[model samples]
Target: MPADQELDQELDQELDQELDQELDQELDQDPTGGYRPLVVVLLSPLAFALVFASWTIFAVLGVELKALLGFGEAHFAVLLAMPMAIGGLAALPMAALAQRIGGRRVMIACLLLICPFLWGLSHASDYHHLLLAGAGLGLGAGSLAAGLVYVSGLCPRRHAGLALGLYGAGMVGAGLSYLLLPLISQAYGWRTAPLLYLLPVLLVAALLWLFAEDREAEPDVPDPLQESPPRSPPAALLRRLACWRLWRLALVYSFFYGTFVALALWLPAYLSAQYRLPLREAALAALPFTLAVGVGQVVGGALADARDFRALRWWVSAFVLVCLFLLSYPPFVMQVQGVHGVIALHYDAPLWGFLLLLSLMGAAMGVGKGSLMRLIHRDHRDEMALVGGLALTLGGLFAALLPLVFAVGNEWVGIRTAGFMFLYASLIACMLVMVWDHASDRGARA
Candidate 1:
């Protein structure tokens, strides 16, 4: 009885020590009188929203710009797509730079870099000038990669998923373009649309510079006996990036985020062509898909913070698959013979039904993306910049490529629903890889 009491006393003491340590950390983290954490966390999403808006402005403006410039379909298509491709390609290099320097510095630079391009685009008169400006705006993708690292660095471990989800939710800025551009175009002109972004971009850039500081991590101590000179930045980045686990995360992210971007880009055109709807009406119909996905990120992030995200991801995938399977079918008609007459069956999804399915699929993708991202930080917080960059790189490249795939599906495969078919196929591949990865992991553990 005495021994048992002693053991219980010791356990109590240990618990008390842990609680004290947690209290100390909380006190230390908010040394600037508690407001700093609030400001930093809240401002991050708002600032990133501006960056996202700047990145996607061409989505709303491209139709008018094409008409104004008298550009061909080819030129118009390229203009709509150029920045995303450029951004995705640039994400890796920018992320490497962010690791060497800091994520905050990279974020500031990215926002500032787009300002000149936004201004140039505002004043651009010819196709070449607009193209040049659009290419420059691609730097905005780098900001997203860096922002992931930046928020991960600042967030407390207990709240990491929620913070990251909020940042991801800033993608609602895409919807902002949909809401604001038509009004701006009507009041001023399409030329004034790009200029509308200048102030918010500049203000966000300034605010980030002034208030958003990177939470510097402690430098690792050198190993005494096995020490050699540290690798150069490029060499170090390349070396760190040579992990199968990291590549797997990239592939998983590409499946969710890439397909999300592809649908966002392809939906307007598909809705218009398939349903014979006006472009504006089609764009409006597609708006809820983007919004649902953005909001789902926040919900997913919060849930993953406390739950098993691998399981969460599986559920998300299943839900999306069901939606995609239905979406992948083209409008079809069937004739059936009856005893006395012939009956015809039609399976063309109504516009509202199509929108509903697309929105649900988007929500699933958002949840998967959020949970996976938080899982990355939970396992590899120290290497967030590198892993985050590589993941964004793959996702961006896939986003850039999926549109072309959709185009090929439409033109060559002769399926108006080809894009959805491709998305469905790609998602299945990702799920298969995940299952294989899990099986291998269990084997290793066993």
Candidate 2:
């Protein structure tokens, strides 16, 4: 061979050797490899459940606070949405830090940081103090960004959907809060409700520290970035954002996950006001929505793992669209002219009917949530943390904004169901985007 060709061949061999070493370093080498990954998968959701419960406790507590502070609906909306707004904006920076330092470390630090805030919330004496404490509680939302990265690294690509889906089920914590926080408040006092969250937060932190392995240590595969030159965190984030698909998915997520967060915060107040139900009964009625979301995520994740994602997305979207349409219809009275006499018709959804529709909507949103995460993994495996954070931030932004929107709509329209009309419109926009994207893809292929 020529001397130039020989040198090129030698360099290629050396590069291959380096790649092998890096892969070996990154992947787990345990004799019971599958067992350890399974354990991580099972335990991650429990920790996430704790984090999610703490993060969203404001929803349950806001009712009592509104009464205690004598705030109007608008003020109460802002108070309830404070954490999600802060958390959404903070997601990018936290995800960047997690990428640099390691998600496990980031997750632990977030859990610890939020503990003092939870303690403070329990002692908050005034509206300002509660706002401060709520802002602090927003720190717990960082755990989701870190947990997504950490769990993604542990599970194999084939099972990524299932693993993330199970982790997503931790959102059932929101429902649990509706059930437990009210009982706790009635038994101990509203002030004692936040104090209870400290136990699970600390316990989950300990569990993660003791059992969870760092991403580098858990996975045996080489980092995809090993071959590429390193970029600054900001640059890396910007690069990910440049992808139009990320933004598209983020918009879709804002509709689904955003609506979920908005409802989680708004439902108790909604039920009590619209249906004239007691506080406890309203919270109980909202429980099914949260439960359905959790169950739907688990089922969706498993199906995504076993089936085609495109089909799953279409089915979930269609189901949710129908639910939103039904939910948007406000109670009305109509008169019909007949040959014999005028007939008057009144239509109003019973509390049970409302709960049933909301439960179904929540389930569809949950499935879409899992599928969205799976799509992120499929398209941006290397940038999961950054992309996940971006997507979540957008969703959180919508979550934060929608409650205020709901409040404004209710104030202006004097209809309790005004929020559902907004949701219905938002879903219509999402469907339009989906259709355009689908057509664009087909045209390009043709």
Candidate 3:
């Protein structure tokens, strides 16, 4: 039978099985709760957090790495971009690899493999060793995208929003790094900072492996709606890339991911340099921004579930506007007034402004993040591989540029240029989203 017919048959079988399960549960005298949804949701985050904590080691330790290794600003920028660059390259294969192994199994393997590299990195005597270790860390961390898919699959459709939101909260590891890693570095020095994370890493992995069940696989299952894999489709591939609706959704994801990652890697360094705060103090300032981002993910996930795509567009647009305003506020404040204006505002004005910007941006991006995934599901359900892969690839590519942009901006335009870049990016993103919203409406009406 053709692939589409096979798919239809599979769906029928799946539906039948689900019905049988439901009926069996109804007949049972006691419907003992197996794994509570709350347990699954909470465990997923804790597992995810361990991975993310390792994912952000370099970002948290950026300043220390620069000092210890005597790296130039440009080299530091390269170090910053490396993980995301590798993650983009690794995502597709990791997704496929997850299918071959299993997401939960692969995720556990990655955690085990990735955590040791953090220790190696802490001990790196030279740049070459650190770069190689970073590559290992990068490849290992790509398992996370696969883990997201796993989490999405585990939940029923009705609860996907809350489930994913819970998963995203694991990003609090980024915040946790800023809050804790710096203190570790201060108390124990940079050499031992990464090692300290080992305790949590081991604990979380052991817990997850014990609690998380493997997702069942059905190899002979048919997907009736799926077209047969094309032997030659060069032109089709090109057209798919150019699909207008797909591009619009990709744009949102790129910004949402790019914003989240850029900060995850750069915020600690930014705080330390701009404010001349000690590593520990800087971490505290950066903590709220990261935590706010985690909060934003939950908020965004909730909103995406409740609202229409049009409402989501407006919400995202408003979010970008807020980010832009927050980014530009300090400069705007300075321009309208003078040096005395700075004094009146006090020395901490820029820091406060940055925190505010980060809070708004993080939450906005979180909401946009889930909505982006939903948009892909809605628009290109059949062609998810091409669309999701390209969106993630592009997001990673853009993310690759951010550290360099910050480094160069600091070199040429002054340290404040980092804020200006955020401001500019936010402005353009807002404009494009508004335009896309209009385009979508026109297309729908037509």
Candidate 4:
């Protein structure tokens, strides 16, 4: 009996030691040799930026296409939004596949898939061809889901927010497109613009294939409570969707990220139509807004790493509310009765004012984008891929829907500011829900 008891104790100690070794390996820095993870962290964004640039190219060139195709505002809106709609549908599945097959593989596949589409876009002759190319272009947007999962695994949790933020700064690709597409189209025609993208996409895919390590290839470290009875990807996704907090975050993201995407696609057209600016001039004017978003994301990520996410959320929400309110105000002429004659007041925002307000709005949304992901990490670290994918999917879903709404609103109301009005209403709803959520949390604690 004494010998049996001693043998049991020895087996338990061996099990504990094995578990400890596995945990240490999981936490080890530079698991793939010297600075390989760092290389990935740096290079992944370049790949993502390239993909994002391709994904949003239609935004810059769609104006020419609209005229060429003889499409209405509604048709133009759908063309602008097609990539996002397809992307939203693809995000979850791609993210889940990244988890299983490895993000590196998934990301490479995304880039490869996008190449043919981009080539197709370059040669497209009709609206149907554009639609097909636009749908395929969505693979670039969906690539983000895989890229995020890949980057998240590369860095430690302490710096994950900043790393992800820097990676997300790839969103600057939109700005790059806004700046470059016009120049390219002017010089070489709109069709030639897509051909330029093929080189970068192919190069980045090669780099990733050669350098990036797959986290899935690492040995699994099992924690009974954390790892036991592993759930299927679909089951995990459904479970995450079941969380009320995920739904709330999805709504908030829809307002911020979705609005950002919609505006990015819509702004040049808006400026040309409303202010009677030439297309090139309008594209140039939209540049500051896109640049601000890129800078804001980096700043927001740093802030999230250093500060409380709840405080960051409050400040970001307030800023967006104020900016959206100001933006929603349409050109107005006010009249008041006077002793002499009727005093007349006409107030219209100049181009600079519009740029300034939109820049600030972009900054606020950028911060919100960075900080919100940190909150998800805090609450759902184990399920980051599922939750993050869903949040992005919802954001893309709104990006798709809001443009259609903007088109319909403008048509029905004959006000170009109708889009901003819709955005303002959405922000108000988000604020109310945020308040309710805070109150509920306090009640639960009490």
Candidate 5:
């Protein structure tokens, strides 16, 4: 291994070069506009981040609730998943409404919508009460689409990927639960922990109302004569929904984003169980993966903006495959006959190495999230609200379902690393689809 001085020198040189390049570039500007686009991208994401925090709060809160209420594992898992499930259900309706009323209005309403749920959560005395609060809180998931439409609307078409990435980075706010929940739950009480969210939610709603610009609610109405008059409204919608390519893109997004969220809730417990780390320590340990994902979104989006991303997708997926292959190995002792004697072998990932691999996997997924979103917008800018809504909906449902899958894998497979193996297999299936898609494209070209 290199000495400390050599590593430090190399790190310092890299940092200096990055800083120098940033300095040489002029001040940051919004796409095709002045500071307004920047304000939209930044402020809306800030609002989204606050709302996003609630989506994962139940995971933190459910541990205590499950015991207090004396529930089984399945019920507890359902409680943890309620927000995402309901939110996914709500996204399409909310997106349709946003397309009518404007994303700014929908965003403000979604932010305000979380306030009452926080109050209810603080007051919840029964499992049903908590479930109701959680379901209501799930409505805030619709804000992902609102934030997407809001941020991308202000920027020019070319910059849509970076804007979406910035908005998606708001997911980092889900980490807030890991930071503040345990402390507040300890200092006050679990009941009072939800109260801490009330003030900020209200404040963000008001700020969005006063400051954010409103895009025209909908695209210009098409002349009736331009369409086939015999087609019914439902038929028109069915045709729109029949796009297989759109479905594929949405499914791809669902896996990346869904996996990010699933791991966010799962890793804390996984780390605690596998390595026998303390619960709080495991939560803290997970911060690197979340942080890398947040930062990587921007880096990936910017790269997509600058060049072709078709090949990048393959390379990144391959990298994740390698990481997951390493992660999927369960701790075991193996024996084999050697030339001289029987040999014994033991294998288990050290905590640091596992965390390092998680960070790498998270980064690659974030890049994929960014670049693929850019591709979606590049092709479907006119229908962004609808397409983005479909993506968010699928992602939320995917996140909601994965915990059960993980639990099933653990129980039936009788392996601690079963979750990773499941992810590895699922990702391989997704990659195979990508390969098929690429081959088809090449054949079509020929």
Candidate 6:
């Protein structure tokens, strides 16, 4: 061969190797993809659990922190909601960050940085120190956005719903940590809980960095612009946010996720105040609620996989409406002490009935959480980043308010009806969104 031809052949070989590597990445993305390493997927959640568990530590320790910091209920609510608020607000930026630095790198960075800050949270002498510490923790935990984006890229389209549900199970770690950390705090004081929490993050971060590989780019995906397409500058990102599906999904997540987040933060306080339950007892009672959420995610994923989009969407929406109705109304069964033994009789109360309904709202959220993203991804392939980021932000923002709203309500409405009103409104809004979505789909078909 001539010298020029030889050089051209050499360059072609290098390009071939690059293409092979890229293909390997796409393969790894599928659940059964060769790159879909079982060990990493199983263990990544352990790291995620640590990050998430730390996110809600304040909620479980709110009373203790309130007394120690000499803060009021409103302040305590603000403190508990701060991490979520920051996490919500920062999700989009973090998603972009993941693309820039790679997901593993960002996650590891946050994991390490947050540990010392968590230690700071344990020993803060004043509000400024606490606020700074909360910011660090929130930024660190917000890495969940990056991880979800990373995982979504890796999982096969067929199994993405299931994988997402399993990944979401990481939230259960928050509940477990809440149950355990307070007990540890009771013995050692609230100051030590955040410090001890650092160990899990450090270990998980190390395992992730060692095991997780960089996700490959999808070069073969059909380009929107056929020829030379100008990359949209970051400044135009807000314009791309015009995808209506993003708002629809965000609305769905806002209600379901809002309920989950709010209930998780407020339930411990509610049980403690309303039932005079001990701290440990209140935490234990809240476990049932969290368990329901975890279960709902799995069930929702399965239902989505099995059903058609029309059926899946309506069923999920209707379930949410029913849950809201349950939240708005509850049938109470009473145990009357009689001559022989306590005989149980059922009575309906608009109050306790609503609380029970609030609990059922998880089932509806579970349906949406598990399945809705699949449909979104299917329809809005090009806008996944925008959709996911906004959906999470909406969810987080709505959730962030539950504790604050409850606190304000307790102060104003004589304690009994305050929280329920917000819960009622949130559920109603969620139900309305679902109903509107169903109606819209029907009209579009017509």
Better of 2 and 4 by lDDT: 4
lDDT (tens digit, per residue) of candidate 3 on 1-446: 44654575466446545754763464353333356334457666876676667667788787778877798777887887887788778765565556556667777777787777888988899988877777777775555666665666555444455567667678788777777777787788877877877887677678767777655564756678879764355666677667666676666677667667766777777778877887667777777777777777787666555543435756666766666655643333222456666333323356776777777777777777766665564345444445665666667767777888888877776755464456466658656776777677667756
What lDDT tens digits, residue by residue, belong to model 4 across residues 18-133? Answer: 65466447656435644666767877788778877886687788789888888888888888889999988898888878877888889889999999999999889888898899
Clashing pairs in 1: none
TM, every model = 0.89, 0.88, 0.80, 0.90, 0.87, 0.81
Q: Could you give me the TM-score of model 6 versus the true structure?
A: 0.81
Write down the worst ten-residue block by lDDT for model 5. Answer: 23-32
**By lDDT, highest first, what's the ranking?**
4, 2, 5, 1, 6, 3
lDDT (CA) per prediction: 0.76, 0.79, 0.67, 0.80, 0.77, 0.68
Residue-pair clashes per candidate, as listed?
Answer: 0, 4, 8, 0, 0, 8
TM-score of predicted structure 4: 0.90
Which candidate wins on TM-score?
4
Candidate 6 has its poorest 10 consecutive residues by lDDT at 323-332
For model 6, what is the error of residue 414's alpha carbon versus the real structure, in angstroms, after optimal superposition? 2.3
Q: Per-prediction RMSD in angstroms? A: 5.2, 7.2, 6.6, 7.6, 8.6, 9.8
Q: Clashes in model 4: which pairs? A: none
Q: Which 10 consecutive residues of model 4 have the lowest summed lDDT?
A: 1-10
lDDT of 3: 0.67
